[model samples]
Target: MILPCTSAAQDGWLRLRQALWPDCPEAEHLAEMAGFLREPDKYAQFVAYDEDGQAAGFAEAALRTDYVNGTETSPVAFLEGIYVAPQQRRQGWGRALVDAVTAWARTRGCRELASDALLDNVASHLMHRALGFEETERVVFFRKELS
Candidate 1:
């Protein structure tokens, strides 16, 4: 797998998104992917390719200057999402995806890296732990229906 992204990979990136959100309608999925592609730096996303140049995974990295949950520093690179194909799991492909995005973060002078998954996502929790992220704090959203 390679460590950088290019314009040529946009189509492959969209494919990866579709794989990750299989339930999303094609029109919505394509629109979401296109929004990222419209960015000036494409700093919001990156693609992981397999040996045959197929998109095996995707890592969406973005820099946020304000309110990163675990750190006080500004301009932290937040990993918005990462997904490796089911067949590609457990083969170090996911870690490679993270590594690729981390390297990209360092270039942008990011002082810290941050990512979050749903509280009950066991696999995500394990992956984050394996990657050396600590349990900083747990946040639970509360909701009440308005009648």
Candidate 2:
């Protein structure tokens, strides 16, 4: 089952997020989850649970008025992150979590939903394609330090 995240689910959500993005500090996940729980209308997080009530995956999304790649509409529903536990993948949990986000975005009057993944992440690329997202474009980013 899919459900909107609440304060009571924060700890579990944090754990799953940490597992997904292992290099990120736990504090960062906590802070970001807090923001979503505080203002659900602009930012939302949904959890997918198995029959035993364990969290299997999660999806975080937000309304982005800024330029969203491949989307012509403003105020696009942007998927910030999504992850399904390795043990729980390929069972439709990921799709269910995304569907929840899609419903939420439509209710928020959004005309588009956008998401991106690292160029080298093949799993993410295939997942997006399976979920009906078309490839927009790809470009490597560069940064230079200033004195």
lDDT (Cα, tens digit) per residue for candidate 1, span 40-120: 353567777788877778888888877977787888888888998888888887888888778878888886889998888
Q: What lDDT score belongs to each candidate, Candidate 1 first?
A: 0.77, 0.88
- Count of backbone collisions in candidate 2: 0
Mark the 10 consecutive residues where model 1 has the least summed lDDT.
2-11
- Which candidate has the top score in TM-score? 2
RMSD of each: 2.5, 1.4
Give the Å error, residue 34, model 1.
3.1
Give per-model TM-scores: 0.83, 0.93
